[model samples]
Target: MTTTTPPTHLPPPYAPTDSDSDPDSTFRHIITSMLNSHHHKFGFLIYRVNYDNDALWQNYLNIIDQQTREYVVLEKKEHLLPHIAWTPMEDREKFEGATKDEIREFFRDWIHERSEDRDGPGAGVDNTELIRWSPRYKACMYVNGEMMQGAKMQTVDFLPGGPQLHVQGKGVVVDGQYDEHDRDVLRRSAVGAREDFEEVEGRRGWDVGWMYFTLRGVHMVYETLCMSEEEWTSP
Candidate 1:
């Protein structure tokens, strides 16, 4: 065996900032910085099934299993995600194995489609009726936690699926104004959100956790199966 002696000099230690000193804040800082963009900034509106007792969770997921219903993609935009929920029904039914990007695109396009539905051919259709056909957990995403301002359009209790709220479990918002076109997008989105959750919405359950972290397809049936088993467990 061979051994060597080290040089007499040593390197400097890392100087920590107040933010870095707080481990929780440091983790949060990393996530927020990564999410501060349009493309990489993500959405996270999801049901959190947090419960200790196994039996209660089982009861809850029995309801979740029944929650899958189907809807058509009227604008030819539907793929893995649509409107507020990530599970878009393929042919008014579901298929397995969609990519995360496909679902994110679904969310992005749905935002765009809301504008089209307003002035485009979809105007002939009653927009409110469209919303009435969605799931109990209506959701949306904005740049930060702040909502875009506009003419008052009705909203159901839609949860936000933006990136910041779930990980370290807190978020901060910087508010801004929305012009007419922007406002139209925001308002119409609310109506669609209401339709999804209005009838089915229940007071978010007690045993449920805050959110289900997944690889892709925020609410897609195929993707959700991969969630922590407790999420779909019912008593």
Candidate 2:
């Protein structure tokens, strides 16, 4: 099918803190440029974990999976994901490595597939076999605010070039340790529209900015929303 170019002109790339030789920086700009807006801007990244170079794991089934259990997860550091006992999935194997282009094409096809109708394929898409959590890669989504009690969430103030250091916030130590290098790599594209708490107090405009990160080594993402907040919040 022939597709016409979108009449809407996307904004120029958002700046990154480490653009000189960072693929993540470039990828962040490319994806965020798609969701440009005058009133509000948003960027979401679904990436494999990096920086935590030595955390071990063994279980990946959804029930025992942190992806499912994390919400009910308590503040106990031992109960946190890395220290949990390892178990295997019954029906499917672990998630495999998905490259930047393969994931990009998946979205492209999904877009064209849905453009014909808004109901969105009318059935569940099977990504369970495709993506799984592994020891090497820890899949993480870019959540705008504080997640865990001590997650080193990157803070991007809407400045001209982005923050020199990731906005420093105190986070918890899991299993008696905290990996200060917390950045999510773009295994897939970006997502969502939750209103991030602005750096300016009581002056919340829409969350508009970009964040750069890198890929992890293990398996992750049996099912992910990329945390689609706009769909959840749209009135």
Candidate 3:
């Protein structure tokens, strides 16, 4: 490879726009772009799991098995009447091998279906219930650590208004009119994580982490890295 000397003249600097100075606009654009891009890539929400145990290995195996199996199949034959035909009960499919676009459509349809299940067995179910039905979809980690008897450290917790004491991992507090829709979405995402953990790992002696949103959804996990308030009403 050839190396060249730099010229004395420099290029013009980037000029800041009105949106660049406005936190709301900047955050909105950045978050919207990220969400849409992720949605487009995975077609569904995909969590980033961090682990250092054998359980995670088992979870991976389960997911792989699901993806390679039949997309949907009937559980058992059911006949309503003596001359009636058997009805098929469709089972939900896994996310393995699914294109990003296909997953997006799947999530949209899943939300729509749950929202309209007003009078069925799924009545009163939240829109995010289906997505949280499996433990693999949750963002979480399994690790080992130790605390000394005289050790003292700063504590952190996530609340409805935002993270208490600190915003995400940044030691700064963001005081603003946080969107209500976004707050509710974040809250529900947190609830789903707890529900999944309780149902799946509670009996196995697993304990809740110190962090409130320890097992949050993938989007919430991303929120820790960026301070964007994109409305999730459309999501």
lDDT of each: 0.24, 0.23, 0.26
> At residue 62, what lDDT does model 3 achieve?
35
* TM-score, per-candidate, Cα-based: 0.19, 0.19, 0.20
Largest TM-score belongs to which candidate? 3
* Candidate 1 lDDT by residue in tens digits, 77-171: 22212122221122112112323223334333444344222323221233442222221112221111111111112223445632211211121
Per-residue lDDT of model 2, residues 11-125, tens digit only: 3333333332344322232222222211111211122212122122111122223322332132121222322222221111112243333333333343233221221111123
| Tens digits of per-residue lDDT for model 3, 22-51 | 443312332233233221111122211222
Maximum-lDDT candidate: 3
lDDT of 2 at 206: 32
The lowest-lDDT stretch of 10 consecutive residues in candidate 2 is 171-180
Runs in model 2 lying further than 4 Å from the true structure: 1-46, 52-64, 67-140, 143-204, 209-235
For candidate 1, the TM-score is 0.19
Query: In candidate 2, residue 223 scores what lDDT?
Result: 16
lDDT for 213 (candidate 1)? 25
Per candidate, the number of residue pairs that clash is 19, 19, 4
Report the C-alpha displacement of residue 42, candidate 3, in angstroms. 20
